[model samples]
Target: MTLSVRRARTNDVPSIHQLLDYYAARGQLLPRSPDELTEHISSFTVINEADNLTGCAALEVFTEDLGEVRSLAVRDAATGGGYGRALVEEIEHNARTIGLRRLMALTYVPDFFARLGYGVVAMNTLPEKVFGVCVTCPKFRCCDEIAVLKHLD
Candidate 1:
């Protein structure tokens, strides 16, 4: 089961949306529309195995020193095989390449992120995230997502 991560192309948007929708329905992540995925396609990377998309993640810059890892999802059939970790690493590599000093994620799987060197943090510490994305989230006031951050510097 060899998998490779590469920058997402327009053709991958449908698969990306499907993957996110799966996790989103389970409340593990947020749902993204195909249009939204296409708009930010360049910020995303997808894991592929023999022409099949197995997983996807995105690095979205919010500030000079901050970025968010969004829409991370692995296919149901591909879970527990290191695809998620690989996608996260690929996003981190992109964050470092773009000179971002920190990367954050609002996730239900905090322990998974913690194992990857991210520390749990207070949501208030990320005002940009709170005011920008959180405010628009349906779960805003009752948000159950945990904030985790990894410093690249």
Candidate 2:
């Protein structure tokens, strides 16, 4: 099964949300609103098979040297087919092209990112993501997600 990614558009928002929600509901990811998705549409890329959006990921720039890979989700039926890794690679490539020195992610599946060359890091190491997103997370006081970083330099 060959899958390809493309920049997300306005019409892709619903499908993207649905994909993310699948994982979010299971506590694997944070939930995002359609409005938020729409607002950050340009930050997203979707993997499509035929006419369906099966996976989605976003790169959120926090500083000149740091960016966070967030909101990554693949349809349940599509997991383990490498859609997650592909989506992450797409974001990682974009990060390098845009000159970011490091990419960070807070994820439940640290092993998955590790296989892609990310190393676990202390959450304190990413103050930008901690203060920007984690502070607002309902699980802020007890975030179980592992922090991982991949240096592009």
Scanning candidate 1 in windows of ten residues, the lowest lDDT window is: 22-31
Question: To one decimal, what is the Cα RMSD in angstroms of model 1 from the true structure?
Answer: 1.0
Best by TM-score: 1
Stretches of model 1 off by over 4 angstroms after superposition: none
lDDT of 2 by residue, 32-149 (tens): 9999999999999899998899999999999999999999998888789989899999999999999899999998889999899999999999998899878888999988889999
Go through the candidates in order and give each one's C-alpha lDDT: 0.91, 0.91
Write down the lDDT that model 1 would get. 0.91
- Alpha carbon lDDT at 38, candidate 2: 98
The residue-by-residue lDDT of candidate 1 on 19-61, one tens digit each, is 8888788877888899888999999999999899999999999
Q: Candidate 1, after superposition: displacement of residue 88 in Å?
A: 0.8
